[model samples]
Target: MIEDHPQRYALVNELHARPFPSLTVPCQAVYLAVKEPIEAANRDRERDLAHLRALLARHGAAHPAPGATHHSAEIGRHVLKWESHTEFVTYSAFSAGLCERPFDPRGSEVFPTDWLGVAPGKRIAAVLIRVEPLPADMSEVVTKLEDWFVPESLAASWVLDEAAIIAGDFQIDPAGLMRFTVFARPGTGARRVGRIVQRLCEIETYRAMSMLGLGRARDLTGRLNALDPQLSSVVAALPDDHRAAEATLHELLELSAELESLATRHSFRFGATGAYEAIVNQRIDVLRETRFMGRQTFGEFMRRRYDPAMRTVKSAEHRLEQMAERAERAGELLSTRVDVERSAQNQKLLESMDRRADLALRLQHTVEGLSVVAISYYAVSLATYALLPVAEALHWPKSALTAVLVPVTFGAVWLMVRRIRRAMH
Candidate 1:
């Protein structure tokens, strides 16, 4: 066989990892999403695997293969599909048959209480969906929907080219579950029904997941508000005195650190939120929704409720970025001020040094002149002492001798001093 890349087999097999369940009409399902802390990305995967195994063992079902991220198995009368995701794990239980009552809460009973209690993370989203045959009379379906969900908040749509009708208020009920109902036309394939149901469940789950970002954004608002004025004051103080600028720089450093910390803490959550929101929208789009009974469609409902929340999240992210940019600009300005001040101080220092150097040079010249005078006087006195005896022998005048000797001594001393100074240089 030709040599193959080590990951080729795994890479090719990944696409078929989570096969869509083949679900028939007159079926019910309970969908659950479990999430840990925002740091779920770094959480231990072994805990999740062990939890899955525990549930599988309870049902006497075969365990998922090692290193598997998704699994599907039959547990008693229901089908169980488990998918591990980046921040959470989802479990979907599909049981064939409808309850005697409309929107029965017991439909979720397929999942054991002990099993759910031992799930790896907190349940973030729990939904109950019912798939039924579309009645020949559309009015009867509309009446039932109104009875089930609040009319003002209900969103109903005919999806997949009117092959099915999907309706939900997207509200949590007293039972702590969001509800969705799908009415598929007769002769619709089981696989098609499953895809529709899965998309509907995904739309709800992802929408709720994305809203976590909005909650984070709201929590950050108060802290951000407090920081805003402090930052503004720092920027405003830039043009002030050196002391003020220095203080502002210190404050800016602290503010920058706080901003970075906040970003570091929430960056992953914000990014994950945006990704989940996009998936929610994409899932809805695939439904190919159309208006039902002149009521609000899924797209319209999201545009009203979900879009605003996402916008708030986006706004928060943008505000944080703007603050960081502002801090950076302020830091640059502070640095410039400090540099300019230092330059001015250096210039003054240089001027003072130049004056001191000039004074020292003048003193050196005066000292050289004094040294010449003193040397000449010493030389003239010594010569007079030696010449006194010689003058008597020659019978010459002492006054003339002394004057001539003084001039000659002065000249000699000046010449000698100049020669020494030149030699030293």
Candidate 2:
């Protein structure tokens, strides 16, 4: 056999990993999402595997293969589907039939409460969904919706080209569980109904997950407001005093550091929120919803409620980026101002040194003049003594000879000093 890439089989199997459950009509499902305080990207997969193993052990069912992120198991009278994601895990149990009373608690009792309490993470979302066979007339559907869900908050639609009618109030009840109902038309295959139900579950889950970013954005807004004015004040001072600019630069650096820290800490969550939001929208679009009872559909409800919160998150992310840019610009401007001030100071220093150098040159000229006069006097005295011996022979006066030699000696000394100065230069 030809060698293949090591991950080829695994990558191919991933497409079929989370297949839709073949759910029948006239049944109910319980969906629960669990999330940790920390992200699951670096979480311990062994812990999740252990939890799954524990649940499997309770039902004497086969364990899921190691490293599996999705599993479906039969637990006594119901079917359980578990999927692990980057930030959370979801558990969905589908039972064979509905309970006697509408919205009864028995349908959700498939998983023992004790087991749920010991799960690895806190519950993020809990939902109860009922799938029923559609009746002949639209009047019965309308009456059932009014009785089951809140009128003002109801979001109902005909999905899958009217192959199924789906409705939800999108509100939490006393049990802290959101409720949904799907009425599948006759001749709709089990797999198709299952796909519709799974899509609805995913829409709810991803919608709730995406809202986490909004909560973080709200928390950061106060800090951002406080930082804004401080940054503005620092930048306002940049053009004036260099000393003050230095101080302001320090503050700007601190602010920039804080902004970068915040960005690093929350970047993953913000990005994940965007991804999950897109998934929610994609699932809703695939539903191809049409209006029901002239009420708002799921897509409309998301637009009205969920869209605003996502906008807030985007606004927060953008605000952080703007503040960081402002800090960087302020630092650059302050640095330039400091450089100019240093250059001006250096110019003044050079001018002072020039004045001192000129004074030193004048003092050296005075010393040279004194040295010439002293050397000329000494040379003339020596010449007079030497010519005294010759005066007796030539009958010449020593004083006159000395007087003649005095001017010549002074000239000779001056010339020698000038020559030495030129050679040194």
Candidate 3:
């Protein structure tokens, strides 16, 4: 799929195919894309002519013929020289111009903005070179060019497979494509060298855009909690679901996982680690907010609901205990009352039984007294009858005897009543 993309694949192939001049010897190059139609091309040509005239004037070569004078300008300590070639100009003078800038003395850094008329999709493209004279041994020139242009720190196995056409191990095809045999150089210093080589090799516009993208990513990540917020918003704003959120997230994660993938591919590093650290710090902020919410919710639950429920339970338990104690006390009081009532009832029953027993004893004593009186009266009647017989025989005082017997009977009845009372006692 990537190969089918003409723009991307063409660009990649061009980068690989082009001959990267040796930076150790100082060189400059530019890749241009022409955008205007035929009519606009003429205007672009006029503009280039005017720029050339300006260069000549600035370098004090204004009176020289168009093809005769090579304009040269002093930029800082280095001299920049511009001359016409068959199809392009040796623009290495621009680098010299950059070196002359006020801050050039600080380091060997190239600033693209210092160029006079460099822009994307311009009508023309060119590079320039000026180096210390090449070594007599052509092999040494090829070796040095390979080392200067391609740093081994980035690719340990990047080698030209074909045999060298040049004695110095450099080969060039008819299309102006040059290849060099390269080997890995391992050391801590190799990293710095690799970086320098990458900058030298890359197109200025592409490198600048990449830096802008990284800056944008950093700023966006800084404001948001997690990458999710940025991702979701971007996904939502998209025209369709063709840019799948899940897929995008996966891609993002993959990008993050292989932190050095792009750097490795470009043979350059783009502050990726620093950007990732910023993202991590943003995520930590999100985590802190989540933790705060959790703690707050739990605290509210405890304060407003759970604590009250527990207090209610405790109160209910206390009330139940009080009720149970009250019931127990009531039961004890009732039991005491019942015992007192039962004792009173028993005392009444005992008093009624004693009265009945006393009445029964009195009735029995009266019956015994009556029986004794009856017996004594019968004995007196028999004695009276015997006395009547004696009187008839004697023919004297029968009436007087009967009277005496009656009195005796009376006396005897009274005595018997007294005797029965004594026996009952």
Q: What is the number of residue pairs that collide in model 3?
A: 5
**252 in model 3: Cα distance from truth in Å?**
81
Q: If both were scored by TM-score, which would come out higher, candidate 1 or candidate 3? A: 1
Q: List the residue pairs that clash in candidate 1.
A: none
Best by TM-score: 1
Candidate 1: residue 72 Cα off by (Å): 1.4
In order, the Cα lDDT scores of the candidates are 0.89, 0.89, 0.38
lDDT of 2 by residue, 1-425 (tens): 99999999989999999999898888888999988778757788778789888988999988989998999889988899999898888989988788888888767777678988888888888899999999999999999999999999899999998999999999998878899999999989899998988988999899999999998898788889999999898888776554465677788889889988988888988998899999999999999999987989999999998999999999998998899898888888887877887798899999999999999999999999999999999998898888788876888787778878999999999999999999999
| Candidate 3 local lDDT, 1-425, one digit each (tens) | 33466588757865654232233322222222222222322334433445555544554553334443234445444334444322223333223222232122232222133334442123332222222323447566445544534332111111112111111111222322222211222221333222323322222212222233344334333433343344344334333435543444454444333333322332211233234234433332322221211123212322453334334433433433443343344334444544665687789988999999899889877876677667767867787787888877877586777777877877877786787668977
RMSD value for candidate 2: 3.3
Which segments of model 1 are wrong by more than 4 Å?
241-243, 373-413, 423-425
Candidate scoring better on lDDT of 2 and 3:
2
**lDDT per residue (tens digit) for residues 174-290 in model 1:** 777899999999999999999998998788878878999998999777789999999998888787785566677788999999998888887988998999999998998999999
Cα-lDDT of candidate 3: 0.38
Clashing pairs in 2: none
